[model samples]
Target: DQQVKQNSPSLSVQEGRISILNCDYTNSMFDYFLWYKKYPAEGPTFLISISSIKDKNEDGRFTVFLNKSAKHLSLHIVPSQPGDSAVYFCAARTFSGGGADGLTFGKGTHLIIQP
Candidate 1:
């Protein structure tokens, strides 16, 4: 069974509006959560992250919120721009590997920014 899931395959948002992407996981062993933004063929670039201990983390226009009780997390982008149109993946990993272990990634949600 897939440990992580992104139920929404795609989302459309108007420029200057907010974009929210959702993710869920069933593995309680995961202590670290990360969001990655990817273009057409390039590798995924790190977006934001939040530890299981913290409920939220923000950087610039990007924010990641974690709800350990519900085994869910979400990414919020304020004032969505055309450049933000890309595939976003939610990833999680256990802290046992000292940050060396491979991350379990979701299917990814394709975000489209309406110009």
Candidate 2:
């Protein structure tokens, strides 16, 4: 099954504190990984990504680290802000598709940053 699991349903963090979210996968064929941030009623926006070839990727306030051996990955947001309060989805692309690209998404993790 294409189950990309985000075990936590929500997290609350104070402003200027670090927030971490975790994800796990059951399939071994997955090759590409992505983290997408989403607001209510809007499409999930791509945040960070890493291929099977890389173990870590970072962009400004966001960092995603993948550990293939453990079948897991984590996203870290340093000094989380209220603006960061939103649902985060963990997705993966293992292969191409007919009408869509490789994308299997988790239910999502809600991150709340208190100002």
Candidate 3:
């Protein structure tokens, strides 16, 4: 079973608009949440992350929000641009889960920016 889930397979938005991507998780033991953006044939690149203790985190045009009680998380991108089009994956892990290779990942959402 997938602990992390991204229900929406894709989203499209106009340039300079905001893009929102959502994710859900089933594991309460997951204490860390992360979002990664990937281009075709390239590795997923770290985007933003939020800890269980924090409700939200932001960096430049990207932000991540976490609702522990609902077991939900979301990623928001402001001023969406054509270059921002990519596949975004939501991931989660426990601090003590052991090893650096352990992360439960969602299938990913493809974001398309229209000019």
Best candidate (score: lDDT): 1
Q: After superposition, how far is residue 82 of candidate 2 from its true place, in Å?
A: 0.7
* True-structure Cα RMSD, model 2: 2.0
Give the best candidate by TM-score: 1
Clashing pairs in 2: none
Candidate 3 structure quality by residue, lDDT tens digits, 21-94: 99999999998999999999999999998999999999999999999999999999998989999999999988
Which TM-score value belongs to model 3?
0.95
Residues 21-113, candidate 1: write the lDDT tens digits. Answer: 999999999999999999997999999989899999999999999999999999999989999999999999986744556899999999999
lDDT of 3 at 99: 60
In model 2, state the lDDT of residue 3: 76
Cα lDDT tens digits for candidate 2, 41-107: 9988999999989999999999999999999999999979999999999998776565436698988
Error of 3 at 49 (Å): 0.8
Model 2: lDDT equals 0.92
Error of 3 at 53 (Å): 0.3
Give per-residue lDDT, candidate 3, residue 86: 98
TM-score of each: 0.96, 0.92, 0.95
**Which segments of candidate 1 are over 4 A away from where they belong?**
97-99
Candidate 2: segments with Cα more than 4 A from true spot: 96-101
